[model samples]
Target: MSLNSNLARKVEVEIPLQSPSNVPEQSTGMVHRSISKKSLATRVEKMLMGIIMAIAFTLIAVSISLEINIASTNRALQDTKVSILNTTTINSNLQQEVQELSRYDRIYRFANKQGLKMNEANVRNVVK
Candidate 1:
């Protein structure tokens, strides 16, 4: 044989093999686990979230109540303004009637019709 064939023979390696039965067996079954409770941090976080939600809801409720009160107050204020305007109009009409009734000419005519004689010395002009 050639020198290359001798080198190829030296490079060949052999190893022993085992049967499948000789390998270790592993169990394939459902795993059993105990139920676990929530952690303290998780419970605390949930409690804080609940409190925040309650506060937010309370604020919303209060705001709604305030808005209702404000609307009612505004309506009341408008009604008061309308009433005042009506009263002012009535007062103006009454003042005009008083002025008309207090006129010297109308009073003089009524007095003459009533057969009342005017005494110039007894008449006094009052200044207000």
Candidate 2:
């Protein structure tokens, strides 16, 4: 019925603040940081992928180096084989020449054709 009473009835009420001791205390050393499971999983997956890629790159480099070494060794072996074959051919030809010169008649004819005189004392017999 009075204006003051009507105004008080229409006003909204508010609660008073309680003492800080009524609320639970937060620990000093505790951290409240949070990461989503999806973000954590993505981070772990990215780390694993990076590790796998590094290992793969290292293996590929080693394999390429090994391949190069093998190719070089193979080339060296081929060159050695070629040198051996050439030496064998030269040895065979030298042996044939020595055999041809070992005949007494061939030696005498060759000395005569070259206008060289053979002395008896200059001839030596090789006993094998």
Candidate 3:
């Protein structure tokens, strides 16, 4: 009792606890985690792109092959035309030779060489 009377009275301090806020605040930009769900969609998109590119390449290759085939076919057609022209020329020459050989003098000589006697009834007498 004597020591308490001699010392000064001690003072007690109280700190108030912080309370939770009731109003919600909006954020400017928020980042969310969703790796597992987005990964499958990304893989599917990449696979589809690959398939499209492969189809495009195949189409290009087919077109190039078709162009080459067309060129070869055109060359063959030109060769055929040249051969036909040569044949036509030969045919015309043969026709000219046949016409020359069908003359009356040539026919008479050919008949005499063949020992074929010309009948008066068969031979039309032409006063040339």
RMSD of each: 11.0, 11.4, 15.4
Ranking by TM-score: 1, 3, 2
Q: Against the true structure, whose TM-score is highest?
A: 1
Candidate 1 achieves a global lDDT of 0.86
Question: Which model is ahead, 1 or 2, in terms of lDDT?
Answer: 2
- TM-score between model 2 and native: 0.58
> Which candidate leads the pack in lDDT?
2
* RMSD (CA, angstroms), candidate 3: 15.4
lDDT of 2: 0.88
Give a tens-digit lDDT track for model 2, residues 1-128.
86756454655789899999999997644433334556778899999999999999999999999999999999999999999999999999999999988998987898899999978898788899
lDDT-based ranking: 2, 3, 1
For each candidate in the order shown, give its overall lDDT on alpha carbons.
0.86, 0.88, 0.87
Give the clashing pairs for model 1. Answer: none
Estimate, for each residue in 33-59, the C-alpha lDDT of model 3 and write its tens digit: 355457768989999999999999999
Estimate the TM-score of every prediction. 0.68, 0.58, 0.61
